[model samples]
Target: MQEFTLEELKKYNGKNGNPAYIAVNGKVYDVTNNSHWKNGEHHGYEAGNDLTEPLYNKSPHGDKVLSKIKQVGVIKKD
Candidate 1:
């Protein structure tokens, strides 16, 4: 598996033909083809950012929704 720093993850913003990726609980998932993450965006949440809080607390769908998505990597530890 690959590892990404938050800064490095920012580059894959699902914009300008970039692949969409979001981090949650130290896991990085590919949201490039997820309809909910069209253009790397869902609701007001943008891709290439750590969405742990919103996915765990704010979104009704919850982190369970990520189970269907493909995990590509993990957040790099210092």
Candidate 2:
């Protein structure tokens, strides 16, 4: 499959209803409706301990979470 830099992906000017693109064999695909990532919560959560002696958990930043997905070869467009 072809690989692209993050900059190239950002140039697509994704539509409001489409947030994802696919790249296979140097081709670009707008897989916004793909079942794999159609939902927003597909990304995992984050857990941390608070100074108050309690546990805290929340989702990471969208960009950070997406970056991790790219690192794992789960998502890539540009």
Candidate 3:
């Protein structure tokens, strides 16, 4: 998989026709087609950012949800 820095990941914020992507467990997923992710903001979570914390602590579902979405890349640590 491709690797993306947090800065680079910020570009795909699901805004202005941009693709929506979020990182979970260091893996990046493209949620552009999901209505819940419209405009890249879902339930206070913004796209183009590592959502591992929220996914584990705030989400109703588990990481398994990412299995259904397309993984476009991985989030690289600084």
Error of 2 at 2 (Å): 16
Best by lDDT: 1
Q: How far is candidate 3 from the true structure (C-alpha RMSD, Å)?
A: 1.2
What TM-score does structure 3 among the candidates reach? 0.90
lDDT of 3 by residue, 1-72 (tens): 989998999999999889999988888999999878869999988999989998988888978787789998
Model 2 Cα lDDT, one tens digit per residue, 13-76:
2345435553333334443444545432123311110111111134233223232333212224
Each candidate: RMSD to true structure?
Answer: 0.6, 12.1, 1.2
What lDDT is obtained when candidate 2 is compared to the true structure? 0.33
> TM-score of predicted model 2?
0.30
Task: Report lDDT (Cα) of residue 9, candidate 1.
Answer: 96
Lowest-scoring 10 consecutive residues by lDDT in candidate 2?
46-55
Steric clash count of candidate 2: 2
Per-model CA lDDT versus the true structure? 0.93, 0.33, 0.89
